[model samples]
Target chain A: MSLSPLAIVLLAVTLLLGVGFYGLLVARNLIKLIVVLQILAKAAMLAFVAAGYGQEHMGLAQSMVAMVIVADTVVAVIALALAVQVRRHYGTLDVRKLTTLRG
Target chain B: MALWTSSLHPFLWLIVIPVLASPVVYLAGRLAGAALARWLALIALIVTCAPCVLAAQELAANGAATFTLGLVQLQFDGLSLLLAGLALGLGTSVTLFSNAYMRGETGEEKYYAALLAMIGVMVGLGCANDLFNLWVWFEAMAVSSYMLVAFYRDQPASLEAGVKYLVQSAAGSVLVLLGIAAVFGATGQLSLASIADSVRQAGATQATSAGLLAAGALMTVGFGVKAALVPLHTWLPDAHSQAPSGISAMLSGVVIEAGLIALLRAVSALLGEGDAVARFGQLLLLFAALNMMLGNLLALKQTQVKRMLAFSSLSHMGYMLLGFGVAAYTGQSAAAQGGMFHMLSHGLMKGLAFLAAGALLYTLYVAKGAHGPLMVNDLNGAARRYPLAALALGVAVLGLAGLPPLVGFMSKWQIFVGGFQAGDTLVALLVIFAALNSVLSLAYYAPLVNAMYRREPSHAVRLGAAMPPTMIVPLVVMSILVIALGVWPTLIAWLTEPAGQALLAGW
Candidate 1:
């Protein structure tokens, strides 16, 4: 059976979420993890806008998604700053070896 | 309808002062001096705190005060007021303590910038009635805090901790937004009040509805990470321990509680019916119980003082969660009231504890060149060296361990008594488990307390001089407040009652 437009959008969203989570779980590098997180944030934005689609007050969803993108950008800037700092401090961006503080 | 007249009258100053103060503190700190910057922080905090204290007193005496922002509404009710007061009051105390604690430290301007901005966003987080506005404030707080945590960028551990914080919380923020998206989609509403109205109209059956449960689970996990609720709590021990102790005070004191309140808002407001609440509350109680037991267990194993305090912070979050769970399960105002009181107690007591520990670290830094592990063993005869801090630490840990005649005990008493029914065996057993966890926490707390007085001083501890008076001032004030509030538990109850009632009535 052919998927409806909503179904296709949802499928795309699901694939994006899966890819993002997979990258988060499997990525060995800090930069990879940050990129994966950005992708996940993107999926969330897309999902939010899609959730608002075909409904009354679609503008609300659009506005919210725009806000989410702004927030995601803020987080990205921080993440990149942190990455530069981490690379400066640790000499590498591999998260697996970044185990300085232990319980 | 004017912007300053009605909608933002009370909170406008509370919000604007700190947000505005961040840049002012940064600029003045660099141009004038650290002394002036510190004075600015204290003054700014006082300016922000005035409205909160007045609002809290007014809320206590006259019930809730409402400030409507067009379609949005901000209520100066008990919970928001109490948490807001905790944020601002502790913001002042932390700034004062930082005056000494952060002395001669590099990047002082940037340090004050993050600290002031974090305080403003936290206060705004407390008053936000619109879900999206609340989320934005929460994210803003997180961003500012990432800077605060990693302020010592020269240190590898600080950056590591900040990186871990950002990586984890990004996912947490996404989850929170996802939950909000689901709720908006389900109800076509973004305002908390409107969402609750939609949920109430949907009735008990929606408790099991796929979309609602997803919303509940997502939001709970989202905020739970920030609140340091169990498995999601790994970032906290590192973040709190690695950050400067003054910043640690704000993190443990205000941020976690605000996270819980935001989570509670999402859960309680969006899941307004009986069945949904019961199920969600059960889940929260499970998380609460786990957080208490496991967090205390973890604390018992920590050798480092700051790290131990971090674990204990997690345990206290469990107590806060227990109170929130009660409100969730039973729609009981008593539990939320207790939770608010718990928030107040945890904020003040933990704030004091971290500052006192920072005093020891500060002394070590001053005496020697760099601070060491801050292990419990490092506190050999700290009492004789830094008497005020040691005394403050003694009182703080006692309060944290939930001893009688301390604020911790008062909050725990309210949580257990208000949440538990008289005759239910399982519930009573669970309450006992919670109480036993508090007692077990003394396993770690007692050593820290005893290390202050019972042991002979190490050469290093004896060499260090006393903490500066500015640092001591906030510690003394907080320790006294913990003791005073404990004695007059009625005072906290009165302040917190309206917060709970407002939440329940709003729901």
Candidate 2:
């Protein structure tokens, strides 16, 4: 049997979340983590739209996505800026190398 | 009366003034230099506090006041006033301390701007009446703080801590965003009051629906990370210890509590009045137990002074959560009032502790021309040279250890009384556990005190410089308030009672 549109959208959402979370868990490169965050943010955006559509407030959902997009962009920019600093200071981009603050 | 007077929309002005003026403050610093910018930042915070005080007065005269701007709603109640006052008070003090502590540090202008932006958004978060707006404010506060955490970009530890904090906190905020979306989907509403009404009207079936339950879980875990809930607090020690001393004070003092208040506000609005409140209360008590045990036990192992204080912050959060759980379970405002009071007193105690530690470190830097983390051993005979800072540190440590005649003891007593008043076996047991944890904290705290007062001067302290007036002034003021409030606990009843009622009003 073929899935309905909502089912297909939900399947996509779950798949994105699983992949994003898996990436976050396994990714060691700083840039890779940033990419993973974007993926997870995309999953959240899709969930918001699906939620809005389910509640018949597509306008509100779309507006929320817009705001999230803006906020997520800022987060990504800052994370990248921080990554550059991390690389410059430590001469590495591996997350495992970030242990100087460990007690 | 002028239509545009701050009294008319005092809470609104509290949010607007600092945010709009932050960039201006930065520009002023860039043009005129750090000194002028420092004054502007202090002035901006004080100006922001004017509206906060006005909001408190309006709240006192008229009970809770709500100001609406389209979909956004701002509420000024006892709870909002408490949070706003804590933010502005700590914000101003930290700025003052930074004037002395952050001297010779690079990027002073950006630091002031980020600090102002942080205080602005935290006030906004405290007063937000709409759930989505609350999350937005939370995100803004987190973003600004991330910058502050990474302020020393040239330092590897600072950068590492900043990146880790950013990644983890960003992940948490995304989870919160998803939870908010799920909540909106379930309720078709966004404001806390509207959502509360919708959930209450829908009855048990809709309230217990998978979607809503998932939303609740998501928000809990999301806010839990920021709140330093156990198993999710791995990032706190590093971030708190590595950041500049003033921001450390802000983080340990108010930022984490802000997360808990957001959790309480969001969850209370979503659960409305039901068995759900009690069930959530049970969950909070479980986290409370874990946080206290783990926080204090780990703190006992810390050799670094700020790191130990960081872990102590985790345990203090546990005590506050104890107050919250009892309040939620018993449906009594007294326990919640205790929680709010603990937030106030803990802010003073922890802020003092961190700032005093910072003062000692600053002295060491100035005298020895050495810089890095300050180990507990570095405090040897510190009291002789820096008597005021050491005294302030003593007050902070004893107060946090729950010694009598200090605000910490009074606040903890209120929480314990709140638990006993519940008369529930489980909550009472939890309170006892929390009490034991307070004593456990002293095992670590006493050493720092001993190192400062009893041991001979370490190399760092022998040639340390005197602390400036800007830093000393805040320390003295906070110490006086801590002792004054402890002596007359009734003085804060005005703040605590209404704050407790505000928490319960959502129900």
Candidate 3:
């Protein structure tokens, strides 16, 4: 079946979400987790843009996606900074061992 | 044309000030210490807030104002005005408190910069009428807050909290993006007003209903995490407790409210069909009820003052959710009005509570000259030691516990009445249960009050030097507002009514 643009976009989003979730759930390292999150955030923005693709005006989706990207970049920088701190303080980036508070 | 012109006037400034202020704060940080940063942030907030008040007045006079950026049209109505006001007010108070609370602390420049950036983002979020724009502002808030949370890079707990908040918030943002995509795919529109019109035009078929339900569920989950509703609220207490007290106040106060507003916008836009409305409202009620029960019950068990306040913040979000849910079902104007009032009131009360806690911690640190780690028990005779700081805490807690003649009681009364008016007896009962929870909250809140007033200071409970004017001024101002609003709720209701009406106008 020849996929519509919308279907292609949706499929790509689903795949990104799957990969991101898998990485987030399975990754042991903080940096990997941050990477997965960034991927996930980007995928969502792509989907939002795809949603507005067929519309006559694309400014709304474009503006939103642009904003999300900016936000994602900011978050990634902060997360990396925090990760660096975590490494210095705990001597490792493993999620399981960093249990100061009981969940 | 008039609607278009009026809406653009105030909202344009609302969006501009923060984008401008972000750099101003960064520049100002170089010239002065924490004091200059605080004043700069306050001035930015005041300027931002003025536009909101003007927007409220304009909306009241002109009905609803619309501003279009390209094809996306944004509305400035009573509801947006109310939220903008709350964000500005809470943002200002937190800035003031941070000046004193964070004095002598390293990284003052970076802290104030992030704080200002976050406030600006929150203002944008409040005024945003477009869903896509709203999403951007939401992400902006998440990013800035993450930096603030992890400001004390030396502390493992702070780093942990920062990491956790970022991961969770990123997940939520992704969900929101996907939901936005789904919404666009179904209706081929990005503006909330346009989407609602399209949904109505299409007539709520099974396919459309399912699409909307899926999108709504995703958006709700995403926003719910930020609002810190139960089950999805795991990251909140740690993050709130670990951040610098000023950031904590803003996180619990303004940030959560922004999330709640986003949820409100999503629900209001999509709940056009009767069946859709009913189904979504039911889901919301379920979450709200759980949030109320679990949040307060969990709070009751926390030994740390800040952690308790964080949990209580979650519980209050539950109350707002309940109000929003009721408004969804009955379309009762009052329910929507109550929801706005609850958001504003809870923001102020929680902001005050967190700031007061911060002041106490600062005082303790100063007097004792020991900074390894502090616990709630360290405040045995805090009232005697720091009378003004203790008084601030007392007033904040009393207000939070819904004591009459305090702001908290007034907001609770509005929400309860809204629940009852909507004829949601179960929710009304839950509101009553929330009331009981507030009374029970006294168990935790009263102790701090008693420790401050009644308890004699042991040798170990050292009295700190007097709190600086910067911290004391905001606390006193907030405490006075709580009492003033409590006695006269009309001050809030007048604004909230117009805000609600604006939301319902297109409906």
Best model per DockQ: 2
Per-prediction TM-score to the true structure, in the order listed: 0.96, 0.97, 0.92
Taking the tens digit of each residue's C-alpha lDDT, what string does model 2 give over B269-356?
Answer: 8876768888888888888898899989999999989999999998988888889888888886778888889999999999999999
Give the per-residue lDDT of model 1 (tens digit) for A8-99: 76677679879988998899888889899989888888778767873456788888899998889989988998898899889999997789
User: Which lDDT tens digits does candidate 3 get at residues B1-507?
Assistant: 455444348766776786678777777777665567667877887778777777777777887777765665666667677767777788778877777677667778677777777776776676677777788788888877888888777788888888888888888878887887777767766678878887888776786677677888889889888988778888898899888888888889888888877877875687676777766777777888888778778878877788888888888888887777777766767777777787888888889989988887777663345443345676678777677777878888888888988988888888788888876677677767777877777877777677667576644356465678888899899988888999999887767888777655534
Q: Candidate 3, DockQ to 2 decimals? A: 0.67
- Note the chain A TM-score of all models in turn: 0.92, 0.93, 0.93
Ranked by lDDT, the better of candidates 1 and 2 is 2
* Reference-based lDDT, residue B443, model 1: 93
Clashes (backbone N, CA, C under 3 Å), per candidate, total 2, 0, 3
Once fitted onto the true fold, the runs of candidate 3 whose alpha carbons sit more than 4 angstroms away are A1-9, A49-70, B1-8, B31-35, B204-206, B366-374, B458-463, B505-507
lDDT per residue for candidate 1 within B1-507, as digits (tens), equals 384564445655677789998999899989998878878888888877677666666666766666776666666666677677778888889988888777778888778878888888887787788888889999999999998898778888888899889898988998888887777767777788777887777553543267777888888899888998899998999999999999999999998988988887767777777777777877888988989988899999999898999999988998878777777677766777787788889998999999999888888763355856587877889898788899999999999999979999999998888678433465567778899999999999998888889558976687776668888889899888999999988876665776677666754
The C-alpha interface RMSD of every prediction is 1.1, 0.9, 1.7
For TM-score, the strongest prediction is 2
lDDT of each: 0.82, 0.87, 0.78
Candidates ranked, most accurate by lDDT first = 2, 1, 3
Inter-residue clash pairs, candidate 3 = B78-B499, B79-B499, B383-B452
